[model samples]
Target: MELDRISNLENDITQKIFSYLSIKEAARTSVLSKNWSHKWIVPPCLVFDDENGLSTETIVSHVLLLHNGPIDSFKLSSRKDLDPNDIDQWIHYLSINSIKEIIVKKRNRYSSSYSISSNLFSCQDLTHLELYNCLLQPPSTLKGFGMLKSLHIRRVTVTRDVLEEVISHSPLLEKIILCKLGIRHLKIDAPNVSFLELRGGFEDVELENTINLVEVSIDQKRGSTNSSSLLKFFFKLPRIERLTLQDSFLEGANGSLPKKLPEPCLCLNFLSISIRLNNLEDISTAMCLLRSSPALQELEISVQQDQHVADAAEVTGWLNDKQNRPFTQLRILKVTGFSCVKAEMDFIVFLLLSSPALQQLEISFGRKAVEVVDFSWIYDNQNNGAFMQLRLVKVTGLSGSKAQANFIRILLSSTSTTLERLTLQPAASAKELWELFKLLGEFINRVSVPAVVLEFLDPSNSVQESDDSSSSSDSDDDIGF
Candidate 1:
């Protein structure tokens, strides 16, 4: 038989080949020769997600014992619980070899949470750390992760004080995400931290010193309406450029909300916030941030689907308030999770009227409309003073409802002169698709904008919005302009 070219390749090229193999598969290559033996034993990355816990643990231990080179990353994922003691030994060994990244994900969350090895904190060269459904108990001697740049903890259990200690002590930490953690009274003092995302039921949040903090997203299960806490938190982010606050985050302001932040977010160009039509405090907070964000260009508002939608009077009063007029610099406005509420429509009109620089408007309904959505108010306002700057309007989550068709009808009438594109995305299922397209197509024939191309995103072929910030859960789906 002729000699194999792959086997005779250079060590660098061989290393590349071995990188694609699993640890077990790579280890089996040792039977080839002594040269192949050493390559398999020293893989640059080790990812263990085997179903059999005992075997996985034994194999990992055996691999580490025979390992002789630096590993770029180590990931330990398991469906069945593995002994934390074994994990400790592995972490200690990886620490000595200068591992740069560590990810431990426990798939079975219904069972007991994984107690991570304290030795993990000793990995001084670690730059990225992600722990899911794990408990982090750093030793008292732990100073900080000197080279750590990103720390992500999801469904992890750590004391408020311990987490604070880990975050504040890390000098190089830039990105921190604490999601669905069962802890409270979180305090962050990361001076170098730029992106911060907190999504949980935190009783309190304190930002001691986040001077470099810019992008922030908070989707709290329950948000306090305390003015002092809100003010103190907002005052620290002078350089915030992008912000998204969703769910019940800062839902109510305890009857006393700040009119505006003293230090404006002058650098902020994108702002996303949750709004409750009935909650004046929520509206007030949204307005406060809008007023403070002078440089804001993109605005996204998620209208909470609350049954107690505010009356037209309350929406009118807030719109008429001089201080509440928002987004003078706003170019793109996106509204989502809207049900056909009188106040919701009124608020949309208010935004259209207030935002003179607005160019693109997008609205995604939360549910199929039960009644026809009246857009006569906007149709009449078109003659008085229209959004001349408006260029594109998109409406998604359509189910061929009379309400949606009527809204599109009004949009076509209002944007006939300036609109370049009118995009509609139906939320109907495969069975209902034909009916939806038929209704919309017929409606467009009767009520269409002049010379404007109509676009429809077929549900079957539609691509789901990615995790990118432009199409984030808190922002509008990124339809490229």
Candidate 2:
């Protein structure tokens, strides 16, 4: 049957069909037949894109005037300047209609400021709410967001009290993302929030009664003084499964691990942390978190560059003498931002020797680190023909270095004869591309691999798959927070 035949279905079915089309596309359906003239006015899902040459304000106003049913979801985007009051009126209309989800995006850099309407606080039916570059001054009479499930606030101006009030009211809220906002302290008491991501410059985040949380991501500045707040957050989350932390998070734990070391985080199976390992305090900080996560199976460490350098003599001495417990469950290790410094190399060697069940090692070299070392020692001196359990090896960000080349060759030749696949990629810069091929030339001739899959990724295309693996978590469908 033709589209017209399809459109001739029952009115409710036609309305459902129209819901899948853009507002403009649905409006154009009026030309199909007189039966379709009013069909576009009652779509449960309405989206207005001003960039498509439809005036968001006029379209939303017109839709509100003609819309005869509850709005299940409404999204409006404006690339042109807008009046804050206009947006307020639109929000007021949606609130009264019991809108289920609202997404407002201001795309133009020069767009006028838009402040969220106070009426939005009364939206009890809203399940998902997202706002970008808007101002939010939550009403004082706000009771709570009893049905809200996800909230994402980015580049918005919201005061600390308003933020706290909004969150406190959201009882069913499962995920929240706060980014690029100028709030200093964040205190969340939401009981059901499972996935939380906090970035930008916030001085502290205090977790009150949010007990069911499973995953947490914190990207912020680093220092020992921040440990007190982190301790409060970590101590509250006994059920956390996956945690990604920047060096700043480690700084907080560096000086404050309880003498009894809060109970081992038995549920935590994955951990990713960025650390400036040159400092003894930072190394110990990382160790502090590691010791607490006894069940961690996958560990990702991004070795960042920083100015502070602890006494190497003390760091090495501790590494050699420290009787730290091994990560017996650990199977995969990925290290990025590697600078090929002695400490970093030592750390990799430590993990290899310590992890008895280790199966895979992924090492990515940073630009500066590629030229720093003669890595011939990586496997050259080891005569123990001990077979490793490793099945996969991936080395990224390879820049030209004879030592690095030799290390790759020796690693493949000596360790884990059962290794299934080897993945190698060059550094982002074109200058470093040749270095990768130079090493690949030697490896292709001597390595014993069943299959070699060469993947060439430019800087923009480069992304750590492990970082994206968080999508496998249950809360992955929640907005990016």
Candidate 3:
């Protein structure tokens, strides 16, 4: 009966196992039964976290004794007290055994320097290497790893010359992520790099040869004074499909070039951008960039000031100019976190009038300072042989006021047939909401066009009253407005 059970256990252990125990604890699994004696010999991957005060030398010796084949991956992160030599020995042993991927993390209270020896660079099978808070001597060349694809170095000091050498050697390299490397001048010549992420202090990075690049993300959090150098580098990105700029301290006043100039005429179909325009001068610079792209279908703009609204007329004129035709293919337009003042409202009206094919329009008001404007002229003009094609209008976070209510009434009155959906969330009682929905429904039924579907949603639904106590929370609350 025991022999049959052992055979059954062997058949049951077909899947791989991942464990976080010390090597000694892992070896004890051999004593579970005869079928498990050699279970620890051929783990596809080995991960050892020094949690139980295991010495690095002891761990390295145990790993050498157990690992006989090429390891698919090896990860070692030690925080306890251990000799640096022992850690170096473990890395050396793993490199000799042809480890394909390796991650080494050292967290000592005192700052210690752990250098990656030249032997590490000679690992021909290594495809991925990640190091955290470790020191690396300048690599002569990364030519040893002929198949290297991804390399990440964070919180380390890599000189510019060494960085250039490594990038020059990796012919098939696709992705490189660098953080806090203290690199002052970065020059990349790799022709096949597809993705590159650079963060830390402002460094003058030149990407003159990445022809097949698709995405680039730069985070400049160090508030460096070198704004012109960075802006020059940003404008030189030739064909990048996606670009993201975050936490840049070069607000236009500091003599930095306008953030919007030198725009790349990329075949970009989607764009999400945030600009810190402190004045109209900066806004004009940004408008120059917006005018460069006439094919954008979806646009999300988050402005930092309310005064930029005055530039809306110029923006609208730029869009409708015969030379710069409007984005006739635009379907969705969203503007958030700006007071819908008269200038902003007029800009939106301009877009609505220009974009004859727009289907959805969403404008989020920042505060209750400005009164909501009624854009019924768009629909009324359409009735007089105008060619407006709007279908849905949504106004969120509605304050119970006359201006907002009148805006809703004007929209319902204007586009009764073409306006198929209207979503309103008002801060009012359920009975008040029911009355508004009924009124709107009757108005739509009287029209010869299709009866528009008007939906009135209570702005507050999370107060948690009992179903019986809350008459407005019932299915009847969905009645047409």
lDDT of each: 0.73, 0.72, 0.57
Least accurate stretch of 10 residues (summed lDDT) in model 2?
468-477
Q: Candidate 3 on 361-393: residue-level lDDT in tens? A: 665434333444644434433333222466887
TM-score of each: 0.83, 0.82, 0.62
In model 3, which residue pairs have backbone atoms overlapping below 3 Å? 437-481, 441-481
- List residue ranges in candidate 2 displaced over 4 A: 1-42, 66-68, 107-113, 222-227, 251-253, 258-260, 310-314, 367-370, 373-387, 431-444, 447-461, 464-481
lDDT of 1 by residue, 263-328 (tens): 888999998877776566677777777788899999888766555656666666777675345568
- Lowest lDDT 10-mer window, candidate 3? 468-477
Residue 34, candidate 3: Cα error in Å is 5.2
Per-residue lDDT of candidate 2, residues 385-449 (tens digit): 33366777888766667556655665666564566667776666536556656666666666545
| Candidate 3 Cα deviation (angstroms), residue 109 | 11
Better of 1 and 2 by TM-score: 1
